[model samples]
Target: MTLRRLISALLAVPACTMLAAMPVQAAELDPVRVQLDWLPTGDKAFFYAGVAEGIYRDAGLDVTLAPGRGSPDAVTQVAAGNADIGAAGINALMEAYAEGGAPVKAVMSIYSKPPEAVFTYEGSGVTDLASTLGKRMAYSMTSAPWPGVLRQAGLDPDEVNMVNVSPASLAPMLAQGQVEMNLNWVTKQPDAEALMEAAGRKLKVLPLSEHGLEGYAYSLMASQRMIDSRPEVLARFITATREAIEFSIAHPDQAAAGLAKVVPESDPAILEGQLRASFPLIDNEISQTEGLGVFEPQRLATAWRWVAESDGYAIDAIDPAALIDSRFLDTAAQ
Candidate 1:
């Protein structure tokens, strides 16, 4: 059967029935906290949809979602056992493994591809990465992947005068010529574009993935101890999340509404644009083939190697497999 049909049929089934039909013994509903990598936005549709649609409750979980300051803060919360799971970039997880010896494993990938990119005004004379040399580039102090992109382009990041700018201020800074370029995520690209169009201007976005800086974007992660002790809970969470993601893909407008409810201050037009921008980044293939929270060992190994070699960590000291667990997702699929 086609995926659409399967998803439709799954949606038709009663949530209680689906929960009761699962073979593995269901765990009692317990409070599970998830720390988001940033504040509410359309990029977080599936998560908000899951909550708004009662997916987590149907899966027998009392889940609480918390906003994180950034990836590092989210990872720290998970590592400290204060949060059951944390949503963050896989790069942050690698850094945590290298520096803090945090036994956190990425359970589910949200964006299949890296969302980082450099944005410049249209006709800025900077058409590509090579042209960005010696230019002023604005970047967030906490964002990952920019360093890798600069290194791969053979540009010393230090050579470019860098300024700290908020994500929302990127387009404004570009429009005013305050910075030659700024790094942003694809998820934020739509909002940036909308903001530019509002002022009757245009911009160019150069995705880092297209420039050879590849890494998984957002992911659901948990500590090794939690995985060992509460595997069932993780599996249930993944199942519920997979249901939510599939729902979002099939019902984009509904997903947008769900996001709007959580982020009421967001402009509908901007939210719609953000949703469209993020569509290509969400990987249906990974969700279908690997189940919900499964991590590809080889892909993760590549990420770890990139981090270790560039960030001054001993490669031999880190094992990628130790930082991921697929059993929970696998169980959920069954």
Candidate 2:
């Protein structure tokens, strides 16, 4: 063989060998499922914004955002490995811990304050917790806030004529006098009011935070196995969510428009009102400073104790650490 041909053959042989040794390209993005606590609302703006803005895609995730029936459903879905992450109330996390589920941890707080409250019509003669006693009250049986509010108000939840209403039913029930009082979140009041106004009525909202019904409202939770195996994915998810939250705060009108696209059934005016109402509740600064999604351990402990004591569970049955993993949030914020 010629010297030039021999050299070329040698290079070609190595090139072929190198090609054989290389690993095959995998899927361009990792799949992740995020289960929301309920139907789309302004409270979930960050999540919707993340998906709408391709924030998850930018973070190397192919995220699927699913609506959960409620907090319990979201917890069960994550615990059963059906979902990679669940956004739900922290109170639900505590309840799950008390019940001994596949350990779950909250990675981020969506609402800086608890989102729940007691809402009444302007002329319902129910201005406070004391007034709600003996009045027909509407709430979802599965809502974590209901039990807390009931216990706090010293009302026999059963004696108050509890009505199981969907979150969307709050306005209609209130307007028709089907229920004299409604338990809901501050963020939801605007939507409820808009619905009532559409029916030529007005409503008043009383935040639970003002009535000693305080606890972490919503958080992003993941299973222990997922946290142990793919923490980087969780961190990336949190980072993207945080960015979406920041964007939502800075541009409420655009955020409302983006959220409206996701929940097409939602009234644009209602969503706009909710977006404005939720502005003060999304405290990205606190989350950034304390580490994304990190609730005060002491507060968590207090909440655990409250749940155990109020629900007649043994104190030893609860372990706050098992219910939450703040380290993922700390690493994500960094």
Candidate 3:
């Protein structure tokens, strides 16, 4: 062969070898099933983003985010080993810990600020804690946050005539004069407001934190068995979750889109608004300073105290440290 032909053949051979040397894609990821506190809402962006964008996959996990009926349900499912991890209101976990027999602990403080609240119609004359006395309340007696909110407001829940209602009926019942106040989360303010507006009224929000229920709002929970036997897996999962949460906070539109991709039944516009409304609870000043996933010990203590007090149990009898584990935040942060 001529010198040019010989050179071309040598280059072609190396190029073919280089093409053969590329790395193969990794195998199917380890599955991690997660249960959320409630249905597919914008506030659940972190988990949806993880599933839609493959953030969990990149971290060597395949996450399945399931919808929950309520916080108590989520906690029960995780404790019963029905889920690998769960997200729910810190209040729910507190009540479960107070009652005993649950085998789960909080791994991350998802919301630094408590979102527990009472919403009333603007013309209903229920403005704040002091004004709610003797008024009818549309509440879920079995929901975890109501007792704490009532005790913080210096009112015995027994004093009020409470009509147990489904969450969907709260705003409508309040507007129709069936109830004067409704127990809810401030994260869902937009939906509550819309519900009231459609009924020709405006909402008067009363956040439980302002009424003295100062504490971490919601948390990521894992079984004690997982922490004990699968420390590395738990740590990795927490870290990936934290990263996904921060990413969703910074890129809400993108996050909403990702969520919509996973939950096609959700309206993207509505989900984005829900996320924007939930910002105050998730991205508070304390969370910014301490880093995401960091829980305040005092907040945890206050929640535990309320659960014990409201349930006729002694606060001194339970160690708050046993209810939460912050060991994974370091890895989550990194």
Candidate 4:
């Protein structure tokens, strides 16, 4: 063969040999089932958005979210190993750990600032903690933060007549005057406002975080088994989640749209409003300084104090630091 023909044959031989080389291996994604503290509300939109955006998949995780009735339920599910990780109230996690020694620990802080609030109709005359005295207030077992809020506001917990009610009944009760106020998170503010507006009344939000209530609220938690056996998986999950949260905060409209694809029952407009309300709770000054998903020591202690006081446990009933493992967060940051 001529020199040019010989060179061409040599190149063709390598191309054929390369095609027969060992097949390239695709990285297997780790499956992570996440339990949510509540149903598919806008507050839980980030996870759905992350899944839609392929952020978790890019991080080598296949993530699924399971809806929950409440934070306690979410915590229990994670501890039982029914879920790989979960979003729940820090207070709920603390209570479980203190009482039954549930084998779960918070790994990433979600609502770095508590979103607890007392909502009322504009004309209800319940403007502040002092004005709420003797007024009918709707509550649920999940309203554990209010007692601490009342104490901080220098009011006895019994001063207000708290009527036990189902979580769904709160907004309707407040609007219909069956209850002057209802305790809930700000993340639900938009929906509650819509209910009030339909009843021809304006909504008035009394954020507990502003009225002497201070502490962490919702967080991402994992069971000890997962933490011990799948530390790398936890790290990848946290990193992807942090990115998801940041994306949600920056593009709530897009995030809401993405969530709508996952939960078609949700109204994207309403979801956008709720996601906007959640911004301050998630990306506050504290989270900005300490970085997202961090459990600041003093803040963790303060959060535990609120939970203990509400549950009538000794202040030191459980060591606050022990309830969290920041190794995953540290690894994610790296």
User: Which candidate number would show the highest TM-score if scored against the true structure?
Assistant: 4
lDDT of 1 by residue, 15-115 (tens): 76878865443466666788988887777777888888989889888878888888889999999988989999877888887776786788877776668
Which consecutive 10 residues in model 3 have the weakest lDDT in total? 22-31
Model 2, runs deviating above 4 Å: 1-26, 142-159, 166-168, 284-292
Indicate the worst ten consecutive residues by lDDT in candidate 2. 284-293
What is each predicted model's overall lDDT from 0 to 1? Answer: 0.77, 0.75, 0.80, 0.88
TM-score order of candidates, best first? Answer: 4, 3, 1, 2
Off by over 4 Å in 4: 1-27
- Please write out the lDDT profile of model 4 over residues 1-334, one tens digit for every residue: 6999999999999999998874443469888889999988888889988988889989988887889999899999998999989899898899997896888989999888889889988778898888988888898765577877888877888888888888888889988889889898898999999999999999999888888777788899998999999989998999999999999888898899998887888888999899889999998898889888889899999999888887889987789899999989999999
TM-score of each: 0.84, 0.83, 0.85, 0.90
Cα RMSD for candidates in order? 11.9, 10.9, 11.7, 12.0
The ten-residue window of minimal lDDT in model 4 covers 21-30
Candidate 2, 271: how far from true, in Å?
2.2
Q: Would you list the clashing residue pairs of candidate 3?
A: none
lDDT of candidate 4 at residue 111, scale 0 to 100: 87
Candidate 1: residue 95 lDDT (0-100): 82
